[model samples]
Target: MEWLDERKMDRGKKPGKLLGNKNSKNHMDLQDIIRESALPFLPAKSLRRFTGVCREWKLQISTPFFAHNQSYSFRDVSGFFCQSPSGALSFVSLNQMAYGVPDPSLKFLPEPVDIRCSSNGLLCCQGRTGYRAYYICNPVTQKWKKLPETTANHGTDPAVVLVFEPSLLNFVAEYKLVVSFASDLDGYEFEIYSSIDGSWRISAEISFGKMKLLPRTGVHVNGVVYWSSSMGRIFSFDLSCERSTIINNIGSSSLGAVNGKLHTACLLGSKLSVSELSNAYTNTMQMNSSAKQWQVKHAVTLNFSVPDLYPRSYDKETVLFLGGDVVVIRHEKKLISYNMKTKEFTEVITEEDTYSRMVPYVNSLVEI
Candidate 1:
């Protein structure tokens, strides 16, 4: 996370108090009031502008406390990033679409790259310019940093996931990039790159024996990362504990984070079954406890079948995101949402046939 070292300097030097009287008590009180009441509500774009309003505003917004509080406070799904097979990228505002407001297409990233995953507000992407080089970028801020290429060669199936913990840094940006790939001789390997160290190295290796790994299907939930194997086994890696465990009996399913807990959904017979971990703790001891089990939250059986979708599609559906009670599922060209409470499915309309990949998007001021 040395990319964030500059933020430490920013935090230490308080911009010389550009906005108010340096010696006046009333002006200091006014700044404090505005910082608490007004700043958090502003959009990331407006917040960036406010950073230029004065040294005080910039320092206030850059504080880790302010960033963390504002991030959790504004958890609304503001928009989504849509990509096309032709390589064009766009941002669709959910707020605008729901209100029948016409929105001009917005460019998502500075480069038209394939976005692998999103955490916090930043996206981990693969651009054409970087060979085996990954990019961590904030689409909202248009700020990006190309990550150092890993030492391992994964061939084609590199299981990559981005884990961004905004609370880790008090006054700067920080994130961890975890990559799992198979070598020609070594089988499966996991590597982690920390912004603090600014380098990548192998962390651990999984002895899957003869089992095959499902590529590009890793999900992070509650500080744990889950990846599926071909034999219906899910590999659970405790990021904090640096240990891996094999979960038995779960069939092909899409994994997602629902309310910061791990959730899995797969089709069983005619029903769409969704289940979540009973507890939120990711520690190995707690997860391995006998009391902790996956609790089925909702199961909805559809009366009709979607043509051209096989039974396996139930588990194969690309889970765009899971937030609150709504879970977004993408199957081929269509994107749909399922409500946990009502058990109703609704189609999310978008630019028809233009979407190749879609991920849940939130606006944030985090920059590299």
Candidate 2:
């Protein structure tokens, strides 16, 4: 393990005298207190390196309380995990100096798995073979847990989403895996697997009549899981009440969440429009369904032509909402990020494979 050099630390700010004494015990205690308070703001990689500083620091850093505080303090988009159609996986770093993993392809898992969803730092993956088991893992720590099988069949390609929100009071990592699959009798059924109880239970609610949820478009906001549908609707499943609600008239667009608020990005002829869903959860419950829920947040016309960027019948293009100000769009073989605030276009990368899925990742210390 790499350790921070003492000489480098000594070269920085020198401590002033406390209680009129430079080397007094009170002065050392004040310094230690300041260091402990500032530790939670650092990255997980830096915290791991600082563990080698002393036994007291290691003990404090290894505690669950510290992990919880650090997770909330450093909640920035570290990078993304890109998975191709052939189950090939890769990592794209938003900032290489601050965030990364030991293995981007996730070779630490027991077998080959396809990543379904990502929340905070945990990844929900389904095994390619055998029972198609579900596994929740932390890529940074390389720790994973294989969940028990669900009562409902997830079909061949169901919409799977992982919901995990770190609590300030609760230190243990609790999460849920929601699967929206075709029902045996009707439209669609929801089966949720909870990590707290280590059990799976099929929800009593199902989708509205004949609605087919688009696979791989599930986004969790607040306590509800939202997915765009092929029938021009947005299907949302509330985890708190275990109920399903449908929001109509939302056209073809990609779903993303920023700071617990839901947003959508849609690409039209040479113009990219981004809209925010106001009163999303509350308005869905009201009987007056005629009120407009979507508010146009940002819309900018592209300087270059993107005539071929439209979705075809066979293959659909994707728009990714990265952080608060940037939206990434996959155009043919290239991935471009457009800043809503600055109105600048930056080419993230060029990929040979056109059918790649990108899931945003945040580097966290929450143990699995």
Best by lDDT: 2
**What TM-score, computed on C-alpha atoms, does each candidate reach?**
0.70, 0.81
Q: How good is model 1 by TM-score? A: 0.70
Residue by residue across 1-368, what tens digits does model 1's lDDT show? 78588887776666556324556777778878888877775556557667888888888988867766666455545556766777666665544432111211224444446766677676787765546577887766566787887787755436777887566334566778887777556456678988889999787556445666665567788788877677776777788877777775346677777778878776544567778877434345644566655788777776544433432422344555665676666654556677786777776667656565565666776657
Tens-place lDDT per residue, model 2, 62-101, is: 9878888887666666667878778788887655666678
Off by over 4 Å in 2: 1-39, 42-64, 279-291, 308-315, 338-346, 350-352
Q: What is the lDDT of residue 184 in candidate 2?
A: 71
Q: Look at candidate 2 and give me any clashing residue pairs.
A: none
> Candidate 1 local accuracy as lDDT?
0.66
